[model samples]
Target: MTIAHILHRVADYDAWRKVYDSVGDMQKDGGVTQESVHRMVDDPDNLLVIHHFDTMESARAFFGRSDLRDAMERGGVQGEPRVELFE
Candidate 1:
């Protein structure tokens, strides 16, 4: 099964841009073999990250990495960003 991550941000574009720029390299690195990312039209601040991993284990392994989590936090992301995991 594929794992999907839905992220919603309530911050301004400048904050989002800053965080996005800081994490640019990390995001380029593939977490899973098969992944697709999308931005929702309903909410410009919302981003949908879809991953089609070889297995749920692989997906979890990637998502559970502390390095990436640290990077995200260090990126200085502000506002209340909601995250939802779906399978």
Candidate 2:
């Protein structure tokens, strides 16, 4: 199994969550098998999102998408996001 981990800050968690929820189809299309989200205890705006994929190629492909950035921006993401992969 492979996983994509993303860390970022959002301006508003509620708004961001709505945008995140709206991308269910995109996530399905991206080969994501499962996902989870976490927030920093002390800094609620900080987020860590995890996505599980069957292969590293799929994980990379999903994260490499240009439109993912646009979605994040629309969700009120506040800065550059950090992405990592694990297998």
Clashes of each: 0, 0
**TM-score to native of every candidate shown:** 0.55, 0.95
Give the top-scoring candidate (TM-score): 2
Worst 10 residues of 1 by lDDT: 75-84
Candidate 2 residue 50 C-alpha distance from true site, Å: 0.6
Clashes of 2: 0
Residues 1-87, model 2: lDDT tens digits: 998899999999999999999998899899999999999999999999999999999888998887777899899998789998999
> How far off is residue 79 in model 1, in Å?
6.6
Taken over the whole model, the C-alpha lDDT of each candidate is 0.55, 0.92
Residue 69, model 1: lDDT of 69
Cα lDDT over the full model 1: 0.55
Instruction: Note each model's CA RMSD in angstroms.
Output: 3.8, 0.8
